[model samples]
Target: MRKMLQVVAISAALGLLHAGPASAQNRVTYKSAKTETSYYQMGVQIAEAMKAGTKGDIIVTLEESQGSTQNVMEVRARGGDYVFTAPPPLVESAQSGSGPFKDKVDPKFTEIRALFPIPSLTMHFVARGDKGINSMADLAGKTVLLGKGTFGATEGEKYLKLFGLEGKVKLADAELSNAVGALKNGQIDAFVTAGSWPAPNVIEAAASTGVTVISLTDAQVKETGREKLTIPAGTYAGQKAPIQTTSLPVVAYATTAMKDDVAYALTKTFWQQKAAMSSGAAWWNGVDQSLMPAITGKIHPGALRYYKEAGFKLNPSQM
Candidate 1:
């Protein structure tokens, strides 16, 4: 619930000048991903913190969005006050006008600023347990769903290449629900779903039938060049033991136009309220200040000030 705020006068535009600290929009809109995903839930918690922490009267409202890649465009157009993004890698792609974003990404994407590095959201590769598949490479010569809903297809392809199965596997892109249905009917041999702790779809997949969560070995993870995260035992049924897997690093960001004090307050509030948010979603447990963004998106001045004052060391390149 958002606290009722006394309406502070708002202008039609709040063009924050890049020469120095500029005026910010007191009334802010936070754009997140689909309601069912972990990104949306975290967006809600972060928006609430933004609303709760401001010393001056400010309104921070959260809205569901298509995906992080889309949110980058929205933020660029000044369509919202804040936005959540895909892994640091994706953001880097969009910002640098490379990879999936090569021709379509806006040049202004560089103006976006990093608020905080969110915990790595992991995608689990699940297959019908009877398939006898134990790892990503096992899918060689089999049908698989790359899960290109929000995360790009390119990353999925990269994972395949790393496993030395790119040319060996037949891949299809589908929505999560449809992909799950396809798996149940044997239309596909395996599918990937990204989630925090216990990714709900993976649970549904296991409940529907015998399933195996395909994990990557350290060597495979190195080959993929993606961060590895552990899915603890019991996170999903039939997961008798912890498994190591490659994961995505999501980042929270705002425009350079956002004021320093507001950024500082919002960042501080999010960290302080982590425990409370965790009670509702175990995903909150992934929030860590030390896990700096691997991509080159510069930190916002306000957030950087708070981190420095709080004594958190940051990579010099980020400053």
Candidate 2:
């Protein structure tokens, strides 16, 4: 009888142990529409920071999606918890509900909050130095390769249309390497891409084939209404001097549905360990904590909590 009682007690203890609240685990997934190197690097940084800060309580998985349109759609559909996207298209999609989305997103989606602002990506029109393509207007009637499956292409088209070059140039969609190769092979007169300083493909292609990155004039910048940014001298491998051109903004967004506690914890950890991320990749080198803008979309409660604790003004719209 004593042995039986002991056995029963052991069984009850085991059951209680098994029924104890399962360790709370918060897992979030991040998706990037296009596989830009910078986006992927940033995702890696975030994942590492989350893991370190959560002490293994939270796990973050990052993957590549089709692009901004698909990423925003999936996030709205609750298919993803976070995404990296450009501000222009994300804002345009959320506001107009037009284009690739076709009215699928709610205008209130503005609740999607910005985590940080990436450096302005400058548009580069690379051509063979001997090709004699001196300016944006010189691509007329020439077969030009615009970036494929990336924001560069979409934004390029918009700017081209704004500049009234819509029908005058033959646009071909191709990957950066292929576009550069086409230029090397003389199949295309020019290739257009927008990216951070020292764009790897552009630098490598120019080094191998002697290509030139054209600068946009002040008139062109004003006409386009985009911010003009300069690629400082020595940013690229062989560039002799600073290159000035109009730039487009790139930003990362976190879903509102993400738990506020987790977002707050992650944001706090990220800023505290900013050096960890900054030192991990060249792209992160220029990220400034002060430049992280107050996003328009729904801000994560956790982020708001962190901001308030830090004594920063918590704007009503951000909340």
Candidate 3:
């Protein structure tokens, strides 16, 4: 009986030791854009980086999102482990209870905090190369598709109105994911998509069927109050000249509900894997410490710790 009791005790101790680290693993939920979009692929890359960086100590899971607006709204029900992507302007709007979030105000919006800057959202107005749609005004009689409930959709509509082509252009009633297909099938003459450049769908459409990206005139771009961005020549198939467009900076965020230590790990891991990630995805190369000022809201305390340790400067607004 004594010998049996000793063996049982030893086995119990070994089991506890093996279970300790597994129990300590931190799980996080990441939400971004639609599955077919570049933003969604970004979420996947981040999740993979987190898993590899922490060696299974921290696990990040992705949740398919319709757009940035839905990502913000989910924060109300999501706990601390929830991480999401959105533009600084949207975060500000949520914080102030204005714009799309005006009527859906909740205290959870105040809990939101910044993590790090991701790639900027660059608008792409793609049309069939053979079509005569070379400029915004060319779309006067063409059918266009702008995915609903996304920054691209809203911005596309706003641009049409700003450029005086609102009612003149026929809007397609279809999802953004299907925009490329619709264009290829001649169901739509053009489509507007916004994501990090070299957007997956855009590349597919441009490669399989030549497409033309509209270059906004300087005056039209300025009227929208968005920063001008120029897509380099030859960025897409058959695209020979630089395309002038507008962009909105985007960022990752979390709420105070998350623990400080977990946030610290997430921030640290992201910077560490950034180089490796950029090697695989060109969009990641666009992100650097210089864009910190573009991040809205206060930085999460956990992330701030990593930034301080790394000696990265932060804007006053971030503090």
The best candidate in terms of lDDT: 3
Regions of model 1 farther than 4 Å from truth? 1-25, 52-58, 100-108, 148-153, 166-174, 293-295
Q: If scored against the real structure, what TM-score would every candidate get? A: 0.79, 0.76, 0.86
Clashes of 2: 6
Q: What is the per-residue lDDT of model 1 for residues 1-319, given as tens digits with 9 covering 90 to 100?
A: 1332322222212332342243244776777688877677777776666566554345677888887677776755673356556566667777778876878767567777787766676767889888999977689888988766445355667777766787898876566667778888998998876667677677778888779998788888787776878877877788898989877777778777787876777677677767777787777776676467453668888889888988887888787
* Model 3: colliding residue pairs: 80-258
Residues 1-319, model 2: lDDT tens digits = 9999999999999988886545466777777544567566667777887788777666888888765666666655663356456565456666566776564667436557666566556677777777777777877788888866666777778777987789999887567658767888888888888776667667777777777687788887888777777777776665787777776676767766667776776677767767776666565555565444424454567777887887765457667
Q: TM-score: which candidate is best?
A: 3
**Sorted on lDDT, highest at the top, how do the candidates line up?**
3, 1, 2
TM-score of 2: 0.76
Question: Which structure is stronger by TM-score: 1 or 2?
Answer: 1
